[model samples]
Target: MTVYIDDAVHPWRDQRWAHLMADTLPELHAMAAQLGIPRRAFQNRRSGAHYDVPAPMRERAIALGARAISRHTDRELLKAVIANARLQYDATA
Candidate 1:
């Protein structure tokens, strides 16, 4: 399973940001812990577990071996089309 952390180039407060997520919740949580991210940031969604990380933590996360991915379209890359599409459908309906 691959872990993805796309740099959040957007501005918010005194730092930049990023998103730490994975194909599975367990993997996502594990990576978050490795990156020193607190458990309070976990966001459970139809896609997966996501954490909005700040600039400092983003670098730390990268140092901890978090693979940086593109924030755009990267979310879709995690889930197979069939599964994700189905999930989206279920969510909408």
Candidate 2:
């Protein structure tokens, strides 16, 4: 299973953020934990299960072995990951 971090381009609270996703929830949560993010931070919505990480934390996630994906250059892979995440959310819900 793979963990993926997208480009940290979403602006919020005076900082840029990114989405952290994975092939499985366990992997996703594990990566978030490794990045010092709390379990309560997990987003389990229909849009897709993910963790919102700041730009700096996004870089750390990449260094910790999460694959970096771009919405601009990695459209297809991003689609698949999001689909899987949605499915995960549905299963849990």
Candidate 3:
């Protein structure tokens, strides 16, 4: 299960943040845990679970096997994430 973070870089609330996502929620959680991110920090997005990871955490996540996305902006990334969620949701239907 590969994990991808949207945006090569982003700024949020004074500091930069990146959108982190995975093919599955469990995969996402496992990667986040490896990066020492607390479970409470998980961001509950309509497109699976996401987390606005700081730059440092983003880098660490990448180093630990998460893929860093650089081609799309936040909106585009969000669209993809949502699509993935819809697919997952539909498969269960």
Q: Going through the candidates in order, what is the number of backbone clashes in each?
A: 0, 0, 0
All models: lDDT?
A: 0.65, 0.94, 0.73
TM-score of each model, in listed order: 0.65, 0.95, 0.73
Q: List the lowest-lDDT window of 10 residues for candidate 3.
A: 84-93
Runs with alpha carbons beyond 4 Å of true place in candidate 3: 72-79, 85-93
Candidate 2: tens digits of C-alpha lDDT, residues 16-74: 99999999999999999999999999999888999999998987999999999999999
Name the lDDT value of residue 23 in candidate 2.
Answer: 96
Please estimate how well model 3 matches the true structure, expressed as its whole-model Cα lDDT.
Answer: 0.73
User: In candidate 3, what are the lDDT values of residues 1-93, reduced to their tens digit?
Assistant: 678876636677778788778888788889888888899888774455576788767778888888777654456766776577445442332
Stretches off by above 4 angstroms in model 2 are 90-93
Of 2 and 3, the candidate ahead on lDDT is 2
Give the per-residue lDDT digits (tens) of candidate 1, residues 20-70: 766566777898888777888775555534777887777777777777766
CA-only RMSD, every prediction: 5.1, 1.3, 4.3
Clash pairs of candidate 1?
none
The lDDT leader among the candidates is 2
Candidates 1 and 2, the one with greater TM-score? 2
